[model samples]
Target: MTITFVHLESVHHKLSKASHKADPFSDARESGLDIRYATISDAFPLDHDRDLHREKYWTTLLQIFPSYVDEFVRKLIRSDPQSLHFLVADTVYVWPTAIARKYNLINVSFFTSPAHVFSLLYHLDLLKERGHFLRKDDAVDIDYVPGVGSMRIRDLMASLSKRSDITGNTLFKAFEEVKKADFILHNTVEELESDTLSALNKYQPNYAVGPINLSEASSVAVSRSLHAEVDITKWLGSKPAGSVLYVSFGSVVQTSKEVIGEIAHGLRLSEVNFIWVARAHLTSSGDSNVLPDGFVEEVGDRGLIVPWCDQISVLSNPAVGVFFDALWVEFGGREHVVRRSDDLFPSDLRSADGQEVGGW
Candidate 1:
């Protein structure tokens, strides 16, 4: 089937440019989709020194999204539109999906997080109704989440659970919106999340066409929002091949100073060669001091910390053998966080084929 892919850049000027540069749609043109990019004119302009004050962030999203959806629908209407089979959109914004509904087109909810997380989020309201969510106090004794297994209440994704006045209301509205769609789309594969996917299918028709990393990156001229001085390639080359731990947590989640200090300290103690992507701006917010005193001095040349670098290129290098999410580093204090193969691989980790290495 022929598909036309359209991207709406709704962030402020800086972020939009970065996203367009790192867009993973250039390969679609070869596959036969008429790809398009639409920049939201009044989007919040994000910069190094600027703060997307929570209020302004949501306001801009509500503002520019309607215009973006309208423009996209206009293009669709002018083209072989009715021939279009489905309207798949991110779970956040509902305007485009609403437009699809008005046009009588099939609408599917596209969730970009792990399928288990998606399932937990989709059923969040049910949890609240059943009293599994304790709203009186943020601390509640919850044993498990719907599709996702035992996780601490604090780890419960903020988007699905209780949020502030504006954010909470917005998330619920979006959650309710997804239920109206024909089905939910996840950027995950059945092999990786078979049980979760099976459980989720009871709600809607689920199609898993992902590792989603398999998609080629955008060919459009792009830029990065992070600093440019770090030479990540050369540094990676200095490390023994496949000996570097690549640490990063995309743009959305920010680590606290305490967590950052703990991680830096642990890496030093662990004596593992690592490349860490630390967004300087995240540290700059609210606190003048973000890292532990003597963090750089303690670790010395063993760790390479940078504001940001081309992640795709860094991962592609043979020097990077293991992937470590900075969020996961919180679990580093535990005994079974990571082990080595033959002894270097994480001992408690199971092999992809299901062979037991170590049980957590």
Candidate 2:
């Protein structure tokens, strides 16, 4: 199969290419797939004059996407690669799927999250029709997502749970596009999301392609340094095997200084050894000041804070006991205690109606 990827030639796209430097496509050409890149200069250009509004940005992208993908595919076919056996793209850009249909090619749309999240997004329009999209003050905050378990309003994608017009509108656009794709690629594995995957109907055949656990040296696992103050490798090595807790909240989630302080206080109170990968952009002051006052003194060599480091390498270190994508929700003015997955989801949802939501 010749797998062609049609994408924008943007800086972020270049970075993603760098991340996938070890292209299985190039290597696996003899194995099965003959890969091709059909890229254009910044297909969805952003505004330089002002900050881009999310809703306007996505709407504009969608408006322009069909024509762009149509041209890209037609040109590729004219060049004669025997027609694209498979065309893949981010689910957010559904134009490729439409192009695939025109050219009689298989379209695989990628979702870079879990099957449960994908399921929620897939049924978002239906939820809206059923009047279940958002909570009314008169109504309860709890609702059952089709494939996923009982979802608390606080637990919904921060966008849908809140009254964010931009995110909700853009999200609706993205998922609506997803439904038209012939195939969906989820970033989670089958066992972890077996029930949710099963719930995907015949309309769109889905695959559990990842939860892509790559090694530090894996071609796809490239790292760029942000904070170089402390040596994370040396720090993790100093601790005992499986003794240190690793805390990081990923890139998108903006965490407050007060919450980080609370985490520091909790770590101090627990008196545990831990490595905290604190990204500067996530903090209020964009510095280690996010740590609570007297935190460094109190923890006293038990904690190591860095702006950024190779998370994969840190997790691979024998000293890492647990790696948590920590989340802290604010409610009732004060910050509610941060909960790990193990704390919140102790059991799976009932599998009735083929709806398997573990921890539902």
TM-score of each: 0.74, 0.70
Model 1 TM-score (2 dp): 0.74
lDDT of 2 by residue, 1-360 (tens): 555654454433444543544232444454444555446643455323112243454555667757866777677778885644677777766476568878887777888877887788787766677676675332345455656886555455556655455545666677877787778888888898988888885557989988665533333322233234345787777887767777887654555666666666667665668777776556534454566667777777888876666676787788876565643332211233444322321233233365533222
Candidate 2 displacement at residue 7 in angstroms = 6.1
- Measured on C-alpha atoms, candidate 2 has an lDDT of 0.61
| Cα lDDT over the full model 1 | 0.62
CA RMSD, predictions in order: 6.0, 7.0
Q: Which residue runs of candidate 1 sit more than 4 Å off their true CA positions? A: 1-5, 8-33, 45-51, 79-82, 134-146, 152-154, 158-162, 165-169, 215-231, 283-289, 312-322, 326-360
Writing each residue's lDDT as its tens digit, candidate 1 over 214-317 gives: 54556432344434435688888787766777777666555456556655655665566778877644542546456678877777776887767777788788
